[model samples]
Target chain A: MVDPEIRVVTIDDLGILRSVQEDPATGRVVVTITPTYTGCPAMDVIRADIRRALVATGHPDAEVRTVHKPAWSTDWISDAGRAKLAAAGIAPPAPARRDGVVPLTLAVRCPRCGSPETEQISRFGSTACKALWRCRSCAEPFDHVKAL
Target chain B: MNGPFTFALALGDDSLIAAQRLAEWTTRAPEMEEDVALANIALDQLGAARLLLTYAGELEGAGRDEDALAYLRDDREFRNCLLVELPNGDFAVTMAKLLVLAAYQVPLYTALAVCPDERLAAIGAKARKESAYHLDHAMLWVKRLGDGTEESHRRMQAGVDQIWPYVDELFTTWPDAPVDPAVLRPGFDDTVTEVLTTATLTVPQVSWTPAGGRDGVHTEHLSYLLAEMQVLHRAHPGARW
Candidate 1:
């Protein structure tokens, strides 16, 4: 059987898995996911998607659980996911700052023109996970995945 | 009611009502970007409400789920602060109210993050991060509008003054609560003062303070808000989109 982690990653493409393991005798895959944020709406969708992916992979019964131990950080997003975001015209989040001091403005490089001269138009964007930014070089508006 | 159950429900009601008010700004905000931002913020609050309400149901050992608790409850049964139930009068009012609530939530959730209850603590940890963003958003707008044109400054200060009476209730506390509301006062005061200072706005000095939402007493606005919010759910019970 394929690893459940791979299935979860394939389904969500957010690289949110903390761990996944299958019981050898019971064939029940137990998947653990770390939520992007406490109030993130994606967690529910991700849980259902993980279950569906496992079922499609011949594991009919699987348990999807959430863990909040180390908490989720933007650093958990994989390289492939970051690339996907960039390709989709969404600037990927910068590495999270540990000091809890939020900068008044973030220097988000535009995904379209790769310009560093992007200004935040809004603190929030199309979704809670992103911020709206306008690129000076391209003069195009894009979403920047927020660092959290 | 059990301590955790009541506590969770209070927090849940606060988020749910705040979400409803925020959602109303979707098409009415001054700008398209503001509309999108308000909706995002509303969705975040809604998500938090769902988690807390679901946990509350579990703690109560009641058969009610998140939907039941959210849609089926009467206004008098809700435990949200009166500040959240007030109508979203204008963009300035919305921002001012959000600033106060978000500032309060930052410290409330931060303290709750260390509660003995593991699930509540986990929720608190996650919520604290979201509240920080909410506070930041409110702060920026409050500053911009308060320090902007004369008209903008007038509206912003009016919004602050209007909401000030409802502020005192947010610091009320009960025994066995996840975090004492009084304990959050210092942090709340500092945060609000910092933003108001930058905005060049003075805090309102109101002699009369409004209270009683925690004990299920709410302003008349709550009924209308609940009617609108609960309509579709009431129309089609058990319906899912």
Candidate 2:
């Protein structure tokens, strides 16, 4: 299913869908999902969507579990998903260094014009997962999925 | 007091109270971007607080949930450090507070990530990633405002001085806590000093450090914050949207 917030990508594409398994004890379909951010309001909606999908697929006895062990990261977003995000006018993130250093500001290219000249308008955007940026070449504003 | 219970409770309270304070800037931040940034950080704090408080309640085994522990308790019952409970006196003050708070949390949560406690480790590992972002954001602002204009520099220095005394309370040693606060002090000092130095702000050398927030003795400001935060929850008791 597409993310309830960003409809350009599916849950699998976004990497929030962690696993689908069958419980040994209860013999029920168990689906596990991870959240990109702890306070993401989309989680409840995603859970409800997963449940609805299961009901439609004849697995009314499904169990959806939320896990937080390894934490979610922007690195998990698939390449195809990144393309989709760009096509939708949202710039995808570069690989985030795991050492927690904030990268330099001048790297993000404009999604619309593919120009390397872009300035960050805000570190935060319309959604928690993205940042606001404006292209110098095309002069169009866009969103960039933040590299966590 | 149960050491683990108190430890978890204190950390959780820190996050909860800090989140509330940051969220107060939702529409009132000087700019729209800042409004979103502070709210985003606030959301991260709230998320960590939920995981922490839920675990704390389980450790206590007293039937209290995150909501009950967060909403039902009076200010006197809170175990948060005084730093978080203080008012957002100025924009610079808010940045100063965030810089200090995130500095402490990055090390604290990083240490906790590898600690022996399973649930705490998991939560720590997850939340630390977000804390790193908060630290970066705070550092950016602290430097920008602290080194900007003469007036901006003056206010930023004042903000740091106002908040510095509260900093000592956060690093009080709790050897029994999941990750002892003493161990995290060095990292905090390093981060804060580097930022303040680059920003051309003097690190305050205050002799009189007022504390006692961990034991629930907070400034009167906490009561007003709590009154607003808990009002809706207390009014409806089990309210849900």
Candidate 3:
């Protein structure tokens, strides 16, 4: 059974990992990661974490490469990933407009009180991928996941 | 653009000029929210430009890193397209240029993200998000300027007119340029049309076109910018923060 308590945040939950592939012939795995923003400080931590996980998982030969191109988006988060985030008490991103025709807008939900009544405190939140929002009902400050 | 030196210079020079222009708004935009917003954009461009110039230098197999390419090149040697190097005439003009550039970039990077080349796809993916945000911000401003007031409309129109010529040069990929137009669809005409329509402005078609960035030619403004951007680094040579 899937553990109910364990949380798997969206890749947006942490940040972008472009790809994770293992080469059986070489017995080497490569995990490609990129930052949400150009110089997000979390990137180093993520790289280290991936390395630790690989080593701990008996894949000591694994390599983590950070690639910055065609950059990252919040949209890459998988359906299963979003479910994990919601169950973890963190809200998930809304559906992306795949058509690229309609303009993007977000109706941020309050994570604290589960209310829709909220206000944007700033366009930039603690990080590039989030916005600072405050709950009107609970009067608590929170970070809203920006729609990429 | 003149020759090899000029082309190399242009690659770095365009980013330098464009970066400087964008940086001018640091803490000087109409509001605090926008101040941070504009600064973020400037920083993103600066970082990308640095990488591109550094890569260009490496491709040349010269010892020069990003700083050398950015700081050492002379004005006439710079080859950035005119649109980027032009004066940031006003907020309206800045917004207009941002709209055109970012709109072009979105699709450009979208195609680039999937390039068979790993590095290109990586860079394209990284740049794509920033380009999307830049385009979104520009669209918001364009709508505001276009539909706001008589003065805003006048300025917006003027801005569009001033920058129209520069648009043509962005697509003129020189024969020897590393980036191939064939790999990516040249969708400038369609993309620009949609944005202009959304902004409620008429797209202008003109025969007077500018070129030479791919060939390494640039205007007089480039030299001064290089002097300022490169001086401290050139003087110190490998100084680190």
Ranking by lDDT: 2, 1, 3
Higher-ranked by DockQ: 2 or 3: 2
Query: What does TM-score give for chain A of every model?
Result: 0.84, 0.95, 0.72
Which digits, one per residue and each the tens of the lDDT, describe model 3 over residues B116-135?
65654665566666777787
TM-score of chain B of each: 0.98, 0.98, 0.86
Please give, for residues A25-75, the per-residue lDDT of candidate 1 as tens digits: 997899988766555666667787778888898877899988765656677
Query: Top model by TM-score, which number?
Result: 2
In Å, candidate 2's interface RMSD is: 1.3
**For residues A1-148, could you state the per-residue lDDT of candidate 2 as single tens digits?**
9999999899999999999998888778999999998878799999999999999998999999998878788899999999999999999998877765556564998999999999999988887788899999999999999887
Ranking by DockQ: 2, 1, 3
lDDT of 1 by residue, B1-241 (tens): 8888988999999999999999998788998888888888888798789889999999999798999999999998999999999999888999999999999888887788888888878877777778888888899899999999999999999999999999999998676787878888888888898899899999888899999899999999999999999999999998977
Worst lDDT window (10 residues) for model 2 chain B? B122-131
- For each candidate, what TM-score against the reference? 0.93, 0.97, 0.75
Better of 1 and 2 by DockQ: 2
User: Which stretches of model 2 miss by more than 4 angstroms?
Assistant: none
Error of 2 at B47 (Å): 1.1
Per-residue lDDT of A22 in model 2: 85
